[model samples]
Target: MDFREYQRRARETDQTPDTDGDGLIVPLLGMAGEVGTLLADYKKRLRDRDTYRLFKESIAEELGDILWYVANLATKLDLDLDDIAAFNLRKTRERWLHVGEKQGRLPFYLLFDEQFPPEEQLPRKFSVKFSQEKQGSGATVVLTWDGQTIGNRLTDNAYVDDGYRFHDVFHLSYAALLGWSPVTRKLMQRKRKSNPKVDEVEDGGRAGVTEEGISAYVFSYAKDHSFLRNVGALDYELLRTIKRLTASFEVNIRSPADWERAILAGYQVWRKMRESEGGTVHLDLVNRTIAYSSE
Candidate 1:
């Protein structure tokens, strides 16, 4: 039967549908128990090996119980199962599709500075040179573009050199992969001053700080995962947190797949830059890539 019909019939048997805090626990606990039971049944089948004669039917029965509890909980909360299923599919589709892997459709990319003058927009292509200098016991990264020094020298500022000094690569990746970076706008003098509201809200200090927060947040996650070395996919909840963080800005239009690419590419360049002590990072917006050049 269809999900809607099954949902409607499922609730008919839900005796505890009071919609109160305590009443909600019935279905919630039921779902958890059924999941546990399903796994336990599988364990028994594996233990019994070929002697597990009714394994298929037993597993199906447990799944039906789980589905009933899930439907009953949704009904209690006044939700439609079919709508929920559709929404979940949409979310997973957007999250799983790789940046360059779509078969027939190009991923949507938004460039917030499209209407602005050339100088006022991020350079479609440019190279930022990072030169590391020694300061007694610490190191500082001098950032330069077009033979002119841009931002101040960066140091880890931590008790140990944890590579936080290379975090700026994350911002550069956002500029290259997602075409949005408040920090880049401020550094390159590309803020949307022609529109005061956009300047204040989109390319302002708070937005720059928000970008930095994302860089720091993702860095922490990367550190525990070997700096994302040889990793293929990112944690879904981590990407969801980034969405909530940037929901107020234009960059929010970028999908989780875009953010994942940005984060991974940034870390890849950062690793090379760190190993080489310093290097020139090339950003190509037209191709959506960031590459490190030791030369």
Candidate 2:
């Protein structure tokens, strides 16, 4: 099954809305406890030089629980597991190796003059592949942060920190790709100023535009912008649809701490605008105007 089907099924049965307020935390913690117990057993078995059958079985079961909780958390966050997995792989590649470079640096081995290992020779990582032969044919989503690379292995501590960093990076990158209004950002500033603890202040009357006015102004500016017009020239219909989307007055963004939230909401608006007319064609992040992107 494709991602949509996986998500639909996860929503229907696999996830529970346990209202203790911790959501997936409780389940995840329980899984962690199980892993801890398995690790203890494995240590004892290794020390005694005894058969480790029970230890391996216990470890496998706890890991399965951890995977389930991870999927549950991803669903609650409105993220696709496969997309997260793929993005992680791409990021790992980028961080450790240059795109065109043959030999890349692992945490330990620095092989600047050698070629990258063939797939078979490369160290095995936690592979997540959508198995066509699985019951539902779900796409494989592998994890390989702990796997050895070249001659060095990523430490557990480093792996966890890197994962969270990648998650934050994804959030920021996605926000930049979607265009959010400047006025919404200003409202966020208003929220910061109104707080008693925040002493740094800007002049009054800033970030005061109504949602309707901003939307209209944005549409008008986009329609008149010379660069946008030329880039969107091939598809005049796209320009027309964007104009209509901005015509709606149902703005979702309301405050400053809501900057990331607002970007997501704006993307939703843009999605509907595309779907209402037909397919989501003729969309480009290049036309977006963001100050940081000036470089």
Candidate 3:
């Protein structure tokens, strides 16, 4: 059955209050609780080998509960499950494919080079502002850069309240310093103009994986630096969440003296993956050139 049909059936059985005005709280809490239960089931199986026989069924039940809550939450928020799934897949495909196909491998040295102009040459110190503004029936986080409105989204309030908003800013700093943004932008433009389908699948996939690697680097840096205590917004939960997400990857940010090194590590991750797929990318930032080859 499709997501829309599942959502429709799930709503019929939902016993939660229809107009109690709990907003996103009920489903949010329910989802969290279900996830905890799912984890606990795995923990039990790990501790006792005899439980292996029941593991599959037990896990399936927990997943169903999780799905029910997720669907209900989407319904309450007026979001379609199919749309969410499609958007997520599209976004992931676009990001990773594009970067890998068009700009997978680069001059290794460029990743280490510091491309950020000196402070004297900088237009202004990098800064961001976060605030809440009424959006629809609830409030959303409004993000601004250099006193100009950039964008806003209905993010988990916990991110703002817990001071995890700096997470993206950290990644942004790395991108600017290493000049990856310009390179990625140019690659994207060229690929999109040449063939939109190729851009979406291959180019986008490369960009997606590159971003994941960058996130891994940023998390490693934050973990080593105590989440940059000087910022005074360090949230242990946020740090833990990031660590858990990137734990599967072996990548780590190695250069403490230069942030550019960390950014390069992120790029190397995508390049390595592309290499395994028989793709090669050679980039020269100074010369403003890119070459792609498939073996």
- The prediction achieving the highest TM-score against the true structure is 1
lDDT for each candidate structure: 0.88, 0.35, 0.49
- In terms of lDDT, the poorest run of 10 residues in model 1 is 99-108
Q: Model 2 clash pairs?
A: 102-116, 127-142, 128-140, 128-141, 128-142, 129-140, 130-139, 130-140, 188-256
Q: What is the alpha-carbon lDDT of model 3 when measured against the actual structure?
A: 0.49
On lDDT, the stronger of 1 and 3 is 1
Give the range of the ten consecutive residues with the poorest summed lDDT in model 2. 125-134
Q: Which portions of model 1 miss their true places by more than 4 Å? A: 50-53, 99-108
Backbone clashes in model 1 = 0
Per-model RMSD to reference: 2.2, 26.8, 18.4
Number of the top candidate by lDDT? 1
**lDDT order of candidates, top first:** 1, 3, 2
Tell me model 2's lDDT, rounded to 2 decimals: 0.35
Candidate 1 C-alpha lDDT tens digits along 121-192: 899899998899989998998888888888778999799898787778889999999998999888777888
> Which candidate model has the greater TM-score, 1 or 2?
1
After TM-score superposition, the amount by which residue 208's alpha carbon in candidate 1 deviates from its true location, in angstroms, is 0.6
Provide the TM-score for each candidate, comma-separated.
0.92, 0.30, 0.39
lDDT at 192, model 2: 32
